[model samples]
Target: MKRSSPAQISPDFRRTRVVDQTGIEERAARFTKRSIKQSSKLQALYQVLNMIDLTTLEGKDTDQKVRQLCYKARHPHDELSGIPTVAAICVYPNFVRVAKKSLEGSGIKVASVATAFPSGQSTRAIKLADTRLAVSEGADEVDMVISRGKFHAGEYAFVFDEIAAIKEACGKARLKVILETGELGSFDKVRRASDIAMHAGADFIKTSTGKIQPAATMPVTLVMLEAIRDFYYQTGKQVGMKPAGGISKSKLALHYLVMLRETLGQDWMSNEWFRFGASSLANDVLMQIRKEKTGQYQSAAYFSVD
Candidate 1:
């Protein structure tokens, strides 16, 4: 693989084909109109602004806090009457058991970050082992970061192979291939990575790890979701979409949901097809939901994403 910055990359790298972009546009417009008719739907979409994955805390012991978060999601009705929790709980491999135990039999899915997350510099053996370990620990899904080194070098095949191997390791568990969109350099690279991950057997194609600075954003997430819609058109298999990073507001979450609903339709509106990945986001969504129901502001300290 040879390394080149986004600017140095050629037109060949920038090319992507959306099979029915016009149809997608039309559907998006129609969904917007329909979404406006359902007040609850509008409220839920607004909660997306506050969805967070809460993968780690740099200086804190997150275990006790994480437990509290899981508890809160399970009992959202207690703190915020008639409000549901955020979509899912995302954590490290070791903590999947915690999330599993906390969310036992709950509708919310347990997603574990695997494949030498953050750096993604581990060997194949380590990465595969990590995936297997997480799935065996009761993770409903696994989020694995792509090998950025190979990707930056234009070794798409290597990157693809690694993702496929990890997917195989997931067995019955779903696999989410994280492109770490920040490191991908451009929309073209992001699109290419999306294609590579989907073709390589990703059940979901996510935007970032939430550990990087340039975490998931609307434009990039928009691009990735578009790629997902295109792939579904060609393959007839829907891949889930997750934008995990810096998405800590209810309003923003709504935008992504709006984007997804517009691009992929109501079929992708459920938790199965859409998820927000931020620790802070869950509480924000909860707060907004509370306001919608009670028409009053709630205390933030009562909510925890630990």
Candidate 2:
């Protein structure tokens, strides 16, 4: 479903309107007001667990850590009996093989970050090699960083070609382009970047790398979702969304679900089209699910930390 090439993208992307920050923020704020009660809240909590891309991308991360994370993805809250596993386990490309082995046949995907993650500052050859290595190591998905420096410098073609090239390198692995909205500086730029990624063959247009400080705010996410909506309306292609970073509370994840359902409708509610890129979010969600089922708040110790 990838576009023919970057040449087909320039026209539509150039026509993108400047997003209104105030209007986007106001609309996003109202989404949190939707009331969710007992049974529905419990279901949404479990959905949050399934939609999470259980991530651990740290400089200090080790082989043992990736294995532990993959285990958590397969057996999140085993004591709960019927709890669903997370959608995937996200780690550095070096851990793709380790995570692949640990999650084999369990159906939990191993997502690896490539393209000089959190900092897209490298040659195109290096980035493609980085992605090829991860896919060769059995990554089910690849989350890649865009060249923010080039994007900010108005080098739209360069950024577009880079994503397209990386998409080719991904082979069978689904490609998620991390726009890193925190560094983009404006909602309009975020929308434009999203357009570039979506048209350049990104299966998912993600909001952050979870490495920067201001990653994945509601307003920013709203902007990207709208971009996805517009792109889908025009292309008949259904791209996915993943809001990574700082979303720890179950309530917040539910709010994001509400926003997604309202903005893109119920068809995009499934894990196939939506995901949460977070590390500690699983434990919080586990606690909420347990509280709903047993009427007691479970401690963090009961849940595995990915």
Candidate 3:
């Protein structure tokens, strides 16, 4: 029955002031080049990077591909030795059961995207029902996208209420609220989104859906992480963070890990607080792990990208 305070709601109603945040442009310009230097010895850092929870896959082909990836990650021998398994398998609601079946006894969590996913353009009743269905289907985690229209119109209360309601529907399963940060209009909006999500009972606050441009940029991520840290300082609750989309390269993932380390310290680097939500990014991490272990380039088909 927890809820966000009225002060955290949108503007002051009747004469709601428009919030302008031109300052984010400056911050983003500074961190746009987020890649780290690649060296022959960069393989040493691959062990600590966040293994992704891919959601862009589908159909029978994707299922088989993910099964192979899971096998290699969990049962690496010889060339695939020592690499860490991905944090979890992410899929649509219908596929949650399949992922659960595939990942049974393997310790990998099953995450499902719900709450009208990419569009989030539905009735609140339907959104809540979708969350319940995904959880009933056995998803260990649920990723729900906030209503961008509500957030954009300064309807912060609506956004916060929706998240709180969804959290209730989630029961024991963790709820990750995706801000789709790229569309939030400004850094303040992003920070506010992070705050609303966390205060409204989100176990984790995420960056993007990979369906929009300017998704998961380093500066925006930095801002979101800072918000998480600040919230923890105030409430003693540790909210997790995920920067999905546009994070495909191994170097990109490592840079994010580095940011998390420097910003939130080593405590948030684990799978519990950090997650990479990308389909193409997993193989890249695996490729780096393979190269480091074997000292040679592995074939594209040697791994799965689904």
Q: Give the candidate number with the greatest lDDT.
A: 2
Q: Per-residue error at 89 for model 1, in Å?
A: 1.3
Summarize candidate 1's per-residue lDDT along 53-123 as a digit string, tens digits.
44553336376766776776566546444455555677778877877888887676777888888789989
Q: Considering only N, C-alpha and C atoms within 3 Å, which residue pairs clash in candidate 3? A: none
**TM-scores for the candidates:** 0.83, 0.96, 0.83
Off by over 4 Å in 3: 1-50, 57-78, 297-301
Residue-level lDDT for 191 in candidate 3: 78
Off by over 4 Å in 1: 1-62, 298-306
Q: Is candidate 1 or candidate 2 better by lDDT?
A: 2
Ranking by lDDT: 2, 3, 1
Give the Cα RMSD of candidate 2. 2.5
Residue 281 CA error for candidate 3 (Å)?
1.3
lDDT by residue for model 2 (220-285), tens: 999999988877767778889999999999999999999999999998998889999999899999
